[model samples]
Target: MTDLDTPAAAPPRAGALRHAAPALLGYAGVRALGLITLALWSAANGKSAHTLLTARWDSLWYTRVAAFGYGWEVRLPNGDVHSNLAFFPLLPWLERLVAALSPLSYADAGLLVGTLASPAAAWGIFAVADHVYGRRAGVCAALVWAVLPVGIVQSMAYSESLFTALAAWSLYAVLAGRWLTAGLLASLAGLTRPVGAAVVAALWVAAITSFVRERSTPPARGAFGWRRALGMLLAPLGAAGYVLWVGHRTGRGPLGYLDVQGQWGNGFDGGYAFARFVGDKFTSFPSALAGVGLTVGVALVIWLYVSCVRQGQPLPLLVYSGIVTALALCASGYFGSKPRLLLPAFPLLLPLALALARLRTSRSAAILGAVAAASAVYGAFWLNGSGPP
Candidate 1:
């Protein structure tokens, strides 16, 4: 049989699914424990767990968009305007579709989408890790992600899970040499969140590197030369299109999106505002310790990213992780949301995942179980408290 007709030459996707099943099941268990904990805690506190997941904070904004298309705004006492246009449309659009097809409310539909997308995100994370490292490391990586402090956001009516799913699968496509699939998923990711720019940048960097490398070596037949170029061309369209549409809608030309973000006090200032915020936290002894903790956390994230580079990770993974880290750290507003924003940068967990994979299986499971229990309690506490902004 010719190359195209060779059915058994490659491992089937079913095999991959089988391999990833354990990781997915573990992730689901951790998430389920978190939900159950939240429910119990909410009952004690006289708050509904369902309300916590589907009706508060960003979830409310998303459902508003789904129920009534855009144009909603709030004028703060300080004269700042918070516009619904700041949110990307994909999650709310999905919410609307789900609500239209079923008897659920828009909020419930959003919760459903997030619930379903979380496992897909875990699967995508597993695929990327398995391709780069091995099955053991892949499972470890997914478990690590599931037990992250801010992981509860993945189960809420939020865009983080959906965005992570798209970003992970897009990166996997890049690694698998499926350029068009990468570009299309990257486009959808762009439609999901502003951080989708990271995925596009990764694809562009990889495509450019491929082109430069190919220029030195003679191209072979059936090489994905022009198709890779097409993927590069397609990568940025979704984000650019949305920005331009916002400009047209707001009549502010091409910078309209920036204006919307600006109203919310979000801008890139090279982490200056963040540093100042950290500094301001040093007024008292306890607050100073908090500042120190923040500083160490930021330093650790940067160090891990540098380790990824030194370890010679795939170019797309490095680029995507770097951009995600940079954007999460440098944004001037919503200091509390940085960790949650960094949830999609799963590549940062690879070094830890590798270390865990080297341990005895029982030891690794013990460590993961402890972390998962702590995470479940923290998630419940977090949602019951201030929660993500």
Candidate 2:
């Protein structure tokens, strides 16, 4: 294997959460700014920010699944069918659990889950970044993730934050050589979103590499090599199980999930559809500016992934981020949701984080402060307008 594929050595696990506290606090501040901005904007427009965050867009679909199990669907005027099954089960399951345990409604429970999970995701990002680079970079990485333009989605009743929290800890587990833990988290991630496959892939790659490196070595004093094998076995279960169940319910066999996504006009076309999407935007002057922005955004994503590879990131991170990037960019539908979809691919931000960590603390704070303000305004503008698709 190339040096780029080398496993990043795990750090001492002691005081993990205690060490992440600073990043968590910073993340909370950024999110608070976003929520405040959105709330003020909504009030000026005579709208309820609570309703916007708790009962709109994809949030409604998840709430439906939580309140009424999954046989529900909507048939659009153009003969397109949108299935609730297209929404994964994990978030709704948690929402149901929260509702049953408390007085909150399903949607409110979803909002509660997302609000709490964002910090978990932030800390997980800090943990993985801290493990590879150092405490400073890890702190920067977590804050950078919170300041993303779609950062507000992390606070909404969506599944992005929850899935990110699971995926992050799963990757951290893989980095820490806790194979069974990684696999278990990967399974839960799969139940959260289709992109959960990325976590599963990371676990498999790391485990296979370990096996190849020590094929004949005796298990160490406490090493249960079987745990590695078990992790590999468990990683795919969540996604596979959900997909197969969809097949059974729809009577379309193993390909049923594809049919469901197809009905929603979603599919992987290797970015051909997306390329044409960007090209078509250039037909008008105003649209052309958006086209240029899209070009730069896509370019930035590619550059970051390449930088990650050149930086010699651990094999698990490379595998996980690569799949997540390809899936987000190559989807044939929901072009506007690309940024939100890319939310969990935090490893791509490492190269930027490391650069930021080297700057003077005051300078870094100023830069991120400015960016966080911009993100706050944009997030408010977005949710008040059409919001992310």
Candidate 3:
């Protein structure tokens, strides 16, 4: 790699805190706005925001897993069975840990974990962007992620926040050449979400490229060798271990976890199912408009990724974002939740964030503030109505 391509070294803890303060504060403000809006909307609608965030939908399943260790299933009227094993174990494990140490219930403990982790995720995002671009871009990137329509999930009793925190830090570690740290974080991410494989893949690609580069260059005495190999070995263990354990428990052998996910109508079909879903959306006028919007959104995401490649973004970020986008767009379940699933693809926002950073401060603030308000309102309405599934 050229000197320009080398990853920026991380600032010390105190320096990092100082540098990232604005971004963290901005992200926290956006989340606080979303929560306040949700609280007001819930009160007006005779509902509880706490219950909405902590006791509903996937949150309930996570809490159940935390309180009782898996082995739960729900049989739908359509004769489909949904197994709790479809959910990864990290978030629940954290919830259980928090609940054990505190007076909180499993659900509340989950809320607490998500609440704390969201800002940490933002910080990791800022560190990565700052390393790639600069502090202003980093701050913008964090704020952009914060104002996403589905950003409220970051503050709920969900695994997205936790997983994003791990993924972001893992990517940062990879960029900084901290192989072991990257691998450990990637493994934890795998334990958190299936998409964690994106992280593992990025690390693997980076390790391979480093090995090739070292072989071509005049090797220094102490160089990239055992550490990189060890990281590659550690990277897949978390996801593989969980999947194998689930298989063993369910008596389905190696494919047991796939069977569990299949019960939920989720599997990798190389985007065929998603293509059909979009086509079905065009059956009516209103639905056709929705389909058009979906198509445009997907196109925009692809264009942004291409922009990153054209700009020669680091290989790790490119690989990580590409895998994340592919998985989110191609998932076969919960059509309405694809946007939420795309939350971890934060690098996709970096190009836009850089543009925003180049704008005048007043202009950028106005744009971000307007979007944050709209996102907060949308999040409130979404939760009060049919939120992410």
Candidate 4:
């Protein structure tokens, strides 16, 4: 056979297997080790590992929503309504679906979804990295995400992993010019979290940039025309519709979601609130020293964004990453829980992934192993119990 026909006729199975093996192996190792550490930590703390990892804090809320279906509300001392409507809904919906088919309870179903979604999110991140950089960079990006201290949360009964999976794939779809798919995924991502704004913003920016570029380059075959652009416009429909419907039910406007978050002591204030809080922390002696330490930490986040921009990352990534970072930092609510809230912004892992990619494979694996172990242990406390307030 001719070389062209020979290569084309080669078995696709081996190639598919080869491509899938590394991602599967790497993600399995990360999740297995993380779960082990979480279990051991729960044992040490005299808590049931199942309950600790699957049924606490926000996870409990999600489980309750899935099992009971909203309508349960309590008037808090602060006069706020604590109801399932306060949550964005996608996670609970998944949990309910899983529970319906599986032997597992709603809480366990939530856990299962989170566990599966973690590796899926990692895979999506790898695809984005590979597309943006190269295969080596993709491996490194997945490794960084796999071993992140807060990544364990992604494996618990939380929406972060699911949201990340949706957002990453949505970003990849946008980059690939699959407008309808991107729009649908973006809508689902928005249904997962308030920060799904990042996904919507990324798609809008990508669409606008593509329109501008098309003005210069001659129209390519099969390119998204205005019709595709209109589909992209329809993406925010899911998120907006849900929020507005909830608001209408509650006799609140489209902005009612923000008002609800405010009841929980959160809102977006353009980083001014965070600045004032940091300033006040410096007014006391010992607290001033602590503020200095915290400033160093914030400086690292600033440096990461600066470095990413300097490296000339893709516009969609830069825009999405910037939105996530700004939303997390400038959010005027629950300042103490900012880290947890921002955990799904996997783009922040990119710089660190690039750095890790420079190391030998074995060395990098060892380092990741150690960090994953530690993160899993720390995650037990962080996910199950109350974090610093």
The digit string of per-residue lDDT tens for model 1 on 112-145 reads: 9999999999999998898889899999999999
Task: Tell me which residue pairs clash in candidate 1.
Answer: none
Taking every candidate in turn, the Cα RMSD to the unseen true structure, in Å, is: 2.8, 2.7, 1.8, 4.6
TM-score to true structure, per model: 0.96, 0.96, 0.96, 0.90
User: Tens digits of per-residue lDDT for model 2 on 1-389?
Assistant: 22212334543666666788889999999999999999999999999889889987999999999999999999999999999999999999999999999999999999999998999999999988988898999999999999999999999999999999999999988887777888899999999999999999998998878777765565552264677788889989999999999999999999999999999999999999999999999999999999999999999999999999999999999999999999999999999999999999999999999999999999999999999999999988898897667
Off by over 4 Å in 2: 1-14, 216-222
Candidate 3, residues 87-202: lDDT per residue as tens digits? Answer: 99999999999999999999999999999999999999998898889899999999999999899899899999999999999988888877888899999999999999999999
Estimate candidate 4's RMSD in Å.
4.6
TM-score of predicted structure 3: 0.96
Inter-residue clash pairs, candidate 3:
none
What is the Å distance of residue 126 in model 4 from its true position?
0.4
lDDT scores of the candidates, listed in order: 0.90, 0.92, 0.90, 0.77
Candidate 4 clash pair list: 266-333
